[model samples]
Target chain A: MITSPKVETKNLNLYYTENQVLHDVNITIAEKKVTALIGPSGCGKSTLLRCFNRLNELIVGTRIEGEILLDGKNIYQNGMDVVDIRRRVGLIFQKPNPFPKSIYDNIAFGLKIGGMKNKSRISEIAEKSLIDTGLWEEVKDRLHTSALDLSGGQQQRLCIARALAIEPEVILMDEPTSALDPAATFKIEELVTQLKNSYTIIIVTHNMQQAGRVSDFTGFLYLGKLIEFGNTNILFTRPKEKLTENYISGRFG
Target chain B: MNIRNITDKFFHYFFLVSGVSAIGILFAIFVMLAMNGLQTFTDVSISQFFLSTRWNPSAFGEPSYGILSLVVSSIMVTLGAMVIAVPLGIGTAAYLSEIAPPFLRETLKPVVEILAGIPSVVVGFFGIVFLGPLIADVFNLTSGLNALNGSILLAIMALPTIVSVSEDAIRSVPKDFKEASYALGVNRWLTLVKITLPAASSGIVAAVMLGIGRAIGETMTVLMATGNALQMPGSFFDSVRTMTANIAIELGEVPFGTTHYFGLFAVGLVLFFMSLAVNLTAEHFTKKYRRYRT
Candidate 1:
């Protein structure tokens, strides 16, 4: 299938102090499609996902040498607004990290901090996002209660609703299901499939079956190198690299 | 049925005895203070002791025994100390916990602990020699010793507690919360103000209440620096005497069984209750903070 790239990284290399974490690599994320990065631990898949929005730049000893482009413009270029880049590209973490606040405030915090002040409009956006994530019915009655009170699945969905409220062009998920149970993981995976119709999503996962089930494109990484990249269906059944096949076939992580 | 069971029971009773003894000692102290302090009311009327502003127990003609002024003075100095300490302490804590490198934090934390260990009398002397004169010069007052001077000294004494406790609270706010806020396009400053600080607010409040308790209970510094004036303080700059200072000043010289000595014990009782109230607030907030954590 042919598609335009929403985000691209070229000759990207990242180092933490003296240790290299991601080698020179290039990849394109298709517009409005879910791309899954699958690898074992320490493979730099999460690092790559963070790079799309420059989240890695905050770490103390990290250094990136290469161009990451959002909409064909180098995000690494001089005079880029990091806050603007982050606003456009939202991220969710492995753990469900709702602020110790109400469910309504969880969704409204992003908008309010971004300078949205109109009360009715903020409520409208909050309700719309919650409905979009299929959490409105479950949480609507208790929007004023602490978000930390939600179950793992509901909390993860609340986080998704939180991201949606901000209206980002792309969303990044860093092992978002790793901390959740199987049922919660299924809910998140299904949400990912549904989300791709509107926003470009880049997900990092260690579970091969999860990548196959949810993603249109899959990139298999091994030991800081992108060993295989292509359609998810082909990558799962017909991987060209031996390491990718070995990892996917359960021989070794 | 076995020696193991006997050992377990022995230790359990031992710890139970230890715990019960602590409460027993506290209760005994309260009873003793109440018994001695209540005796003063027999000689001096309760309304005069509590409501009057004059406190000259050694007046030549008619000795007065009011404590309202002393209470007001203590409150003034404590409030003034808190005004200076809370912001500075919380800011230093935030910097240490959120921004300071590991090496600096490690070095500075021990330094703060040492600051707490400095003898209060020595700190009080420093207040007399340095801070009191500086304040008098700055504010163009006749005397160097004042409530502001005592407040400054007490704020220095309270910094270690406030800084360490607030730092622990801020640091305990999960890193995940900060990361989530940052991912939503908020910067570190905004995240700290909005999410991190609010999340840690109960703990920070507990720290502040503990600091207030420390300032109110402090005797030597206020005794030396606050000029020990008997009048009710009108502002932070006024010379004043705290209840702790009053008790310390009069107790050593007063006759053991006289109304003056018993009156001092009554003041001690009031001071105890004041600190108890502050400490109970701190404990309550600490419990509330723990609830948020889990």
Candidate 2:
């Protein structure tokens, strides 16, 4: 038996004014699985990740030509609310962009925006999300402190918890652990592995070892094209495309 | 020493002379005002100057210079202008720095700043020609010039400073703060209120103080539009006189050594102290904000 794709992108083209960024791309992300998009810098991996939730719409002069379907509904359809889409398909950025607010408020921000008004309920959800992200033990005592005071790794985890507090079905992470130390990177990878059991996860990363360890499926992107994608074991060990072989073998970035 | 050493000594002397000259000018002005006005403080009760309403310096064939009415009128007009300018200026700044597109912002920002370059007399003329009559007709008054007219003119004059300084401060906020708010799906207005404005609070306060300083020190606009009545402002439409206006109007008429002459000096001293206090407060907040950003 086979399952339907949770998110499907068909002929997705994005341009920054006269400069084309992502060219004629097509991909599908399986539901409730960890899928990683791997590429070098400026390979359009982050841009493609932003399409799932329409985060690119915030930039001026950014135009997109494509169909991105979330659970079979076109997200770009007329009258579709971008806020609602973002709430359901949350995104964590490359850098740890925590709000200059309390640690608890950082997680509660999304919930309050989504119309979750009950204070007790917000606290409950924030605590649960922090625990799920494995940051509860370290920050449980200072929940009222500013989020910016946290270490880089802890801030990234706090961002993850913020996204999780919204109860998003799919979480998009763009180089989530790249800014962290080795030990924090290991901890995030463990958290990602555990999170995949409940939520569909798509991550963009340049670290091949990280992708290999955390992702069950891998898609190789090179120069704005999805060159090849398959099970992580086969794609890393025996890639069919010469470009993928060259990229993974470390001949060139 | 060589010729070069001699030239360097001359240059150091030039710097020292200019720096000391600037301070000396300020101290000279203070001492002059104090010496000229010392008799008023000794002979006249200070409370009388602060409490009495009549400003007829020539009344009863004697100098009857009471500035309580003029001071109160100045405060009223300045307060009214601040109430109008601060919100509009800060809102326009927030719009320019955070919301307006690059094209619109580029065009509107300079247009807003151009208000600062226009001469204050020209602004007063405009108020006298336009706003004064409009207000006079609405209130069925005999004269067009009044506190309302002066306040409207001063508010327009103060707007450019408030908006430009505030826009700079809001622009100085880190881009990451905005990104964090947007990522949470909070709307633009809420983010400005909750995050951006709070982070830039000290800067905004400084901008307001600068605007107040500009409004209080304004002379020509108040002289022309406020009717120079030297009476307490009973309402927005009532004619009034400010301390700056009083000094400008009376300085040439009073004899050089009479009580009336020293009364003008006293008013100047009051104006000087008010501006100094405002500037010092702004400086303190600016330093506090700089430490926070660092």
Candidate 3:
């Protein structure tokens, strides 16, 4: 017996006002795997990631045509709560966006929204999630401190911990490490590899080497089209498309 | 010296002179008021002026000239106006900056601001002619002009100041903060209450302070609608007088060398001090918020 894909997109098309941003696309994301979407700037990688959680709904005049399935259920169907969908499929933004609140409160926000009223249980879960992201030891003594005071790398990890506290099945990261230094980026890459054991992960990144290091599967997008996709090792070693070859080889963006 | 050095020194002196000149004018006005009014403190006991109620400076033998009742009346009217102005003004501001659609916002913002540009004398006339009669009819009172009517008119006059300032404060909050809250799956109302309002609280408080200062100093509206009565007001329906109103009313009657004249000056001095304190407090809080936000 085979399990269904964790997430699948069927003939997805997107437009911003009159300008089309994403062409007809079809892809399937497996469970408990790390998939990276690599492309140049303005190539619709981030746009495609945003489609999974409906972040693009905030923009006026943006239209999407097609269907997205998560766990064999259509996400855009009537009576499906966007908030509930977002809670199940969490997103970590590129910039670290910790609330101007206490570090503890930042992690507990989603749990509170999900109606977890027991204080002790919330504290336990917050601690567990923070430790899972390797930030508990550094911030345990000062969990009440303002999140803005944390270092850039710590803030990014805290955001990941925040997303984890919601107990999402699939985590979507939009270039989560592009804003960080090399050391911080390496740490985040390691965390992503470790997280793939239990959670299906999708990431949009511009770094070819980082993608090769962390991702098991990679999809190359250019001009809103998926040019090529395959195992990370195979794609880097032998890309079928010339555009993918040129992009991975640094000939042009 | 070099040309660049000379130009820089010239510019620095120009800025210094401009700033000093502004403060210097304020100091001059305060010193003048004090010099003209301080004699009242010496001639009559300051305690007598503050504690007594009788305000008949031209009475038969006693020559009573107490202003305590007027001061009390002024506080009462200003407080009443603030009770009506602060909430309505701030609510209008929130509606304009946060909730109103773009087309409605553009229309309502200017309409609210136009309330400020109307001359105070026109507001005074409208209060006496229209609002005073309507208030008197509603309450079935003997006189139309009263403290309640005055407060209502002043409240309308203060609305524009509060709305404009508070709207600016709300608009100044960073967009990223709102986006972060939305991404957390928080609803619009909760995000506004928990994030946007708290972040802009210092500015809102400053707006309230500025509104209070304007209400306290307003003269023509209070003078016309309040019946210029120098007795302590017992209720919202009773006629009363305020510090600015009393000064404006009595300035023509009091002789330049007399105690009554100096007492009016003293009232002006008190108004100046009150507004100065309020402005300074608002400035302090605004600076504190800036430090944290930056």
What's the TM-score of each model vs. the native? 0.95, 0.91, 0.89
Worst 10 residues of 1 chain A by lDDT: A1-10
The lDDT leader among the candidates is 1
lDDT of 3 by residue, A1-253 (tens): 1154799888889999999999987778888988999999999999999888877887778999988999878887888888888877888889888877899998887788778999999999999999999999999999999998999999999999988998989899999998999999988999999999989999999999988998988999999998888888999999999999999999988
Candidate 3 docking: what grade? acceptable
| Alpha-carbon lDDT of model 2 | 0.88
Highest DockQ, which number?
1
Point out where model 1 deviates above 4 Å: B1-24, B60-62
lDDT per residue, candidate 1, A96-117, as tens digits? 9999999999999999999999
The per-residue C-alpha lDDT of model 1 at residue B5 equals 100
* CAPRI class assigned to model 2: acceptable
Ranking by lDDT: 1, 2, 3
**Given the true complex, what DockQ would model 1 score?**
0.79
Model 3, span B1-294: residue lDDT tens? 999999999999999999999999989988999987787887767777778887777677676667788878887888899899989988899889888888999999999998898998899899888998898899999888998988898899888988998898888887666766666666677777777777788888888888888888889889988997767778989889888888888899878888878878877887788888888888887786677566
Name the fnat for model 3: 0.26
Q: Could you tell which candidate, 2 or 3, scores higher by lDDT? A: 2
How far in Å is the alpha carbon of B240 misplaced in model 2? 1.4
